[model samples]
Target: MENSRFWRDPAVPFIEARDVLDGRHVCYARHSHESFSIGAIVSGHSTYLNGRARHRVGQGTVVVMNPGDVHACNPLQDQPWAYRMLYLDTPWLTELQHQMGLGAHQDLRTFATTHSDDPRLFAGLNGLYATLTNADLAPLAKHSATIEFFTLAQQCLDPLPQRAVLAHDKLGRAADFIRANCTGEVTLAEICSVAQLSPSYLIRAFKQQYGLTPHGYLTDCRIQFARAQLRRGRAIAEAALDAGFADQAHLQRVFKQHLAATPGHYRAHSSIR
Candidate 1:
C-alpha cells in the first residue's frame, strides 16, 4: 500500500519532514532544491542518482543531498520502497556547518557520497524521524532528539569540503554587525552598509567567510544567547523572545539543532552540578 506522512511546525520553519513513505512505487524525476535533504531507506531497494553518478541503495541506507545537487530515486523493477526524509533549508544547513566548525570559505559540506550503508546513520536518522513525527512528544523533547540524531550522523559520516580558500576580511564587518545585533532583527541593508559591500556581494562573501549566511549567523548567536539564558534559569518562552526567536518552539528547534539538547534539558543538567 502506498502511504505517506508529512509534518511541519511553524517554529521550526527551516525544516520540512516526510516522516514516512511506505510501499511507494512512484519513480521520481531528476530534481533539485534550494535546501539540503537526507533520506533513510527503511526497506526495499532503489536506484539513486546524484549528478552524473548512480548507485543502488537498500534498507539501512542513508542518502544525502546538497542544495541544487540534481538527483532522483526510483525503485528497481516493481519493488516497493519505504523511507523517511528531512528537507533542511539552506540557512539551517549553513548554521549546522558553523556548529560543526567547518569554518568560513568552505562550501556546503556534506557526506562524501550520495548514499551510505552505514548502520549508525540509518539508526540515527530512523530515531530522528520517529521523534520528529511523534505528536505525543513535546517540542523540547523532539528538538533534543533531532539534535542528538544529527550529532551522531555528523560524527559517523565524515563531512567533505567542497571549495577552496577565500578571503575572510571581506565579510568581517558584516559578521561583527550580525553578531552584535543577533538578539534583534538585523536587516540585510544594515549588514551591507557595515561591510561596505553590495547586498549580493555581501551575501556571497559572508557565507564564504563564516560558513553561514548573515541570517544563519544571527540565528547561531541567538541560539547561544538562549543557551546562556537557559543556564541562568530563564523561562523558555522568555528566552525565546529575548534571543530573537519567534517563539519557544522556534527556540527549541534551533537550540536542539545546534546543541543537541533542549533548553529544559540544558537547564536541568546545568543545575545538577
Candidate 2:
C-alpha cells in the first residue's frame, strides 16, 4: 500500500503527479491533452494502442506524448502494469522541438524511448516532490526541478513518426527559415525575405501549404524551439532567447496559444527519465 502511494502523487502544481495502477485499475480511456504527458513504467508491462497500432510498454521505459495523440493503455498480464508520469504543456515541448530543430506542427503523439542509465530520473522526481511538500524553496526552486526533469526527457525524445506526411512547397520554405534562424528573433518579414515573396503572398501561400500563415508558423516554430531547449537543460528565459522569442513573456504568450498550458507546466511534466 505504501509503495503504491509513493508513485501516486508527486504533488507538484502544473505537473500531474505520477500514478501507479494495477489489476482492474489498468486502463486509460482514449483522450488527449492540452499539455504534454511523459510516462515511465515501473512494473510489469502493458500494451499501448494508439490508433491502429499497438506498442508494448514496460519497466525502465519512457514515453513522450504530445497533445492530441489519442492513445490507451492495457495491462499485458494479470500482474498488471504500474507507472508514474507528469503532464506538461505543449509550448514547453514546442520549445524543445525548436531547440532540436524539429519543425512546427500541432500533432501530439506517443513514442517509446529510453533516456538514461541513471535511476535519478525516477529518484529525483520523488525527492523533488518531498522538497516541494516539506521544505520552502524560492520561487525558482520549482522551476529548477522542472528544468531537471526536462533535461532527462530530452534524452528520451526520439522522433518516431508512425506515419509521414510531406510538407508543401511554401510551408517547407517557411520551415527552412525556422530551422536556420531559431537562435534569433524572426518575423514574417524575415521569413518572406528568405522565401522571396511579399508578406501577403507569403502568408497566403504558407496558409495554403500548411494551413498556417507565415507568422503563425513562425510562432509555432519558436514554441517548439523553446521546448527543445528546456529539454536540453536550458532555462526558460534562455530558451526564450534561443528559440527566437523577444523575451520569456513573449514566449509564454505564444506557448499558451498552441498549448493552453504554460512553459513552466511543460517543463514540470517532462521527467528526467
Candidate 3:
C-alpha cells in the first residue's frame, strides 16, 4: 500500500482514468496502451521516457502518450510526482479529428507529447479530473468536458504542415492526381495502378508521404466537402449526395459516429466564421 499511490477508476467503455503515484516511489513501469493517455502532473517532478526521449514533468505540464509508445516514469531523487491521466480510444480521437478538420499528421499517427501553460485549459483540466474522480459529473457533462480537453490539447500542440509534393515526375503526377480526384470516389486500387505499384506498397508509401492511408485521406476529403456544403444551407440530404454519400442516412450515421454530431446539429452549433 505504501508504494501504490495509484487510483484507477473503472475503465469507462472508451476512456480510462488513473491517479498515479508520486515521491521517491513514484513509478510507471514501461508500458504501452491501445488508447492515448493525457496526463497532468499535479505535484513534484516526474521523469518519463517516451519513445526515444526522456522528459521531465512539472506542474501544469501535460504529457500526451500516443498509442503504443513505450513510456516509463519515476520520481527524481528527492521529488516524486502525482498525476491524473485519461486514456482515450482512437475512435474518439478520430471523431475529434473530423470535427476539428485536422489533416493527416505524423504526430497523430502514434503518440505525442504537448503542454499547456494556459491558465484556463490547465485549471479546467484539473477541475475536470476532480469531478471525474468524485463522480460528480453527468454523462453528458463528462463527454462535453472531454471534448473541450482535446480541443485545448490540439490548440496547444503545433500542427504539422501539409505534405510537400516531390519534384519527381512520377510521384508528382500521382500526388496531383490523387489530390484532384479525392472526392470522386477514386479507389486505392486505381491510385495504385496509376502509381505503378502494388496496392499494399502504394498504401505504405502514401501513408509515409501523406501521414494517412489513401482511403482515410479520401474520407477526409468527403467530410471536408460535406462541411462546406452544410455551411452553405444545403439540406443534409442534398449535402450527403453532393458529398458522394450513398444516401442521407449513410451520411448522417458516418457524421454522427465519426464527428460526434449529426450534420444538421454540427451546422447549427458550429461557427460559420
Candidate 4:
C-alpha cells in the first residue's frame, strides 16, 4: 500500500496536511514543533504518549498536540495504523482562537490532553484537511472549513491549567535538559547533575513524573528529530547520525519498532505536494 501522502495548499499556507495508510506499525519519537497539530485516526489502533500520560487510540480518535509538547504514537502489535493529520501554524491558530472567543492571549490557549474520542472533532478536522488540500475548492469554502474546524477543536480541547506543582520542577528541568540534548548522548549522571538529585531518586522521580525512564525519554527525542530529517528528504544514514543513533541499522530498528515503517520507505513515499 502507499505509505503516506503529504501536501500543503497554497491557499492555506499556514497548514500542512498528511494522510497515512497502514501506519499501525509506524512509530514516532518524542518530539515537538512550533505549530499546533491535530490527527484523526481513521483506522487501526495505536498508543499515544503525551507528557506522562498514555492513551490507546483507535478509530475515531482525535489527537491534538500543542506547540512544544513532547509526544509520540505507534501502532499496537502488528495492526495497521492509518490517520489524517493537520499542522497549523501558531499565528494562524491564534487568529482562529480569537475568532472563537478565546482571549487574545496565545499562551492561554492549549490542548489539555493528548487525544480524545470526540466524533464531532474528528469529522471537523478530517473535513478541514480534505477541504484545504482540494485545489479546486473555492477560497470561501476553504475559509469556512478552517473556521469550523478550529471552532470545534477549541471547544473540544481544553486549555492548559494555570497552576504548577513545585515538586515537579526538578523533573521538568531534567526533561528540558533531555530535550535540548536529545540529538546527542545523554546519560543518567548528566540528568541527575542537572536535576540536582541522586541517580536513584531521579530515576524514580522522573518515571513517576513522566511515565518513562530517562533513557526512554531520550530515545523518543532522538527519533522525533530523525523523523524531521527524513521528512526533509535526508538520507537514512545522515538522519541516523544527526539523530544520535548508533548507525543506520540502529535507526532502522528503532524506527520500525516504534513506527512500523522503514526510513527508506517513508522517504520514498513523501513529497511536498
Clashes of each: 1, 18, 3, 9
Best by lDDT: 4
Clashing pairs in 4: 23-81, 24-81, 25-259, 25-260, 26-259, 26-260, 27-258, 27-259, 30-220
TM-score, cand. 1: 0.57
Q: So what's the TM-score on candidate 2?
A: 0.45
lDDT of 3 by residue, 1-273 (tens): 332222223333455455555445444444444467777777788786665567777888777766544456677877756776777777777667657877644234332334445666567677667655555556667667778877876666644443233434454455566657855678767777778877777777765554456675565556657866775668889899888888989888766543334687656633211
Best-performing candidate as measured by TM-score: 4
RMSD of each: 11.6, 12.3, 13.8, 4.0
Error of model 1, residue 261, in angstroms = 34
Clashing pairs in 1: 105-208
lDDT of 3 at 217: 56
Off by over 4 Å in 1: 19-24, 104-107, 162-273
lDDT of each: 0.71, 0.59, 0.62, 0.78
Expressed as tens digits, the lDDT of each residue in 1-273 for candidate 2 is 422222122334355444555623535444334467666666777777554457876776555555534456666766666776566766765665556555556443334442333465566555555444333555367657776766655554555554244355655676687657756667777787777778887777666555455565566656766866664557888888878877899888777555444677666644322
lDDT of 4 by residue, 94-192 (tens): 777666667656443776677888888888887887787776778689878887878777778866543234368888899899989999888888999
1 against 2, candidate with superior TM-score: 1
Candidate 3 clashing pairs, residues 3+ apart or interchain: 22-81, 23-80, 66-111
- Per-candidate TM equals 0.57, 0.45, 0.51, 0.74
Model 4 residue runs over 4 Å out of place are 8-14, 23-35, 43-59, 65-82, 88-108, 113-117, 135-148, 161-167
- The C-alpha local distance difference test score for the whole of candidate 4 amounts to 0.78
lDDT leaderboard ranking: 4, 1, 3, 2
User: How well is each residue in 103-149 modelled by candidate 1, as lDDT tens digits?
Assistant: 45555675666787888888888887777766677888877776677
